[model samples]
Target: MKRSTLYKDELIVQIMGMTDKLQRRFQSEGVDEERSWMLQQTDNPAVISFLKRATMMMLHVIDAIVALEPVNGIRIASHLGIPRGSVSKITRKLVQEHVIQMEYLPDNKKKIMFRTTSLGKEVSKVHLALHRHVNMNVHALLNRYTPEQLAFLAQVQSDILNTSLVKEDLASIKDDPPPAAENPPEAMDMRQAAQEDPIRDLLDMLHQLDSANLSKAKDLLQVVFFAGHNG
Candidate 1:
């Protein structure tokens, strides 16, 4: 076999191994560990119990309500790229947990809206802090790569998503809607894609970095990548 073909096969094996490791690392055990870490950050029993009971989807719903109070279910569904029915179910649980409360506008009594209660605000605060902690670590790691390297990584991720297998899966989903929900299969595919893609989130954060931070990041990357290469 050609050396180039051998190298390509090895690279594919390495990539697949890394993907499998990442998948395992973020499975249920990883989630429970993160949830435990978040739980330790607060003393309130209600918040503790709520955190214990809440799924990631439930936490996201509360976070959305905290960020966009007086927002209705449909808007939350759209904002989160989830089904309205799923949002409805999550909000009902949130209300039951007393993390969020239902409200009706005086002008439109028929349209129900959601707002976080004091408990919910506390929960949101903790969740935000947890994310900030995670982001800080991720940012520190990513700062080790130059902007060019980051862009290359993004392109690789995009390529993976655009592969024929993923495209076929998406196409099939559009034709065969799930039996449990009335939502269009296309919307479901989009939601699943959004959940699976951290590259998009990373790109957004990179774009949002202030000039001072961006310069600092570039300097760090130069030291980490360029300095090593030149040596």
Candidate 2:
């Protein structure tokens, strides 16, 4: 029984190793495809600029939704750790921008309800795609490690995730408005509310670059990883 249990544990670890490798392989290819898609979508300078601001804005809107009760503007902002006035402004802008919906509660005249619209959901999905693109590329090299190596790597990743890496990433995105007529300063302001996030910066970087950086980043990543230890 003891031997059987130990074998199962080892097997699980081995499987984890394989899965991690597969994840990296998938990400490497996926980042290539994602970059292609991003390029096609952002061919115009105006579009690229607008997307940068839009991406930042949408993240805060989503954060509010995830953290709050989908209640009205004031309450949602209050619950989600944002200023009520900022929430009200962003909510109104989002509704006008057609990324979210606001409906008055039936029983209450003063209270209103808010939720992501179909458009909002689509934007959110795109944002998620952008996030995944960055994550896969950044962690793609981890698959090269052995099972024991992967176990240690995973712990390190978890620790990093829980720390300021996230904050550092968010702070990288610049809040300056894009030069497009379609995307106004109001758009930039709302977006700036969430610009202090690392994930958004990573996505922005991925959206701006080609696959060449992917390989370089991967090689540099391996160098950094291997530099710390004996094996």
Candidate 3:
């Protein structure tokens, strides 16, 4: 292999390693323990119960409602770049948990709007503090890098986001023929299997992030990479 190709391969391996590490860290029991600690700080049974059951996506929906009270499901979906169906499902659960409630305009009784309840606000407050703590640490670590280094890192992130693998994988999946009845599940092609890759899902999620959130994500990645190197 050419020296450049070798270096590119090494970079790919490093990136994959970093992504795997992040996935493991997020899914680890330690994170759950930390969440449990956060929950213990609050005494409200409703808040505690809701927090315990809330997924990250659910919390994100609550945050959206907090920011955009009296918002409809369509508006929330547009704001978050998620599907309306997903927003509807999450909002339904949020209403059941009493963290969020639905409202209808007096002028249009059929129009549904959402807003956080008192318990929802409390949960939002706790989640906001959690985010603040994480962001503070990430920002402090990121501050150590010079502006040029940060700029280069940002460029790297952009390049990764614009990689062709994601496009090719998606395109190939879309162009594939439907499986024949005689084909066993194990007969699935490599391109079809690529659809199940978590990295592709991660890339899709990154693409959905707005500029501010993307910057925060880059900072968090830098922190994770720096910590990995030191450890």
Best candidate (score: TM-score): 1
CA lDDT, candidate 2, residue 151: 47
Q: How would you encode candidate 3's per-residue C-alpha lDDT over 91-198 as one tens digit per residue?
A: 999899888999999999999999999988998888888888778989999999855456556656665666676455554453353333333344435325545778
lDDT of 2 at 117: 68
**What are the per-residue Cα lDDT tens digits for candidate 1 across 138-161?**
999999985545655765666566
TM match of model 1 to true structure: 0.68
> Which of 1 and 3 is ahead in TM-score?
1
lDDT agreement with native, every candidate: 0.83, 0.63, 0.81
For model 3, the superposed segments whose C-alpha errors exceed 4 Å read: 1-8, 27-34, 168-231
Q: What is the TM-score of each candidate against the true structure?
A: 0.68, 0.38, 0.64
Clashes of each: 0, 3, 0
Candidate 3, residue 48: Cα displacement in angstroms equals 1.6
* Candidate closer to the true structure by lDDT (higher is better), 1 or 3: 1
| Overall local distance difference test of candidate 2 | 0.63
The global Cα lDDT (0 to 1) of model 1 is: 0.83
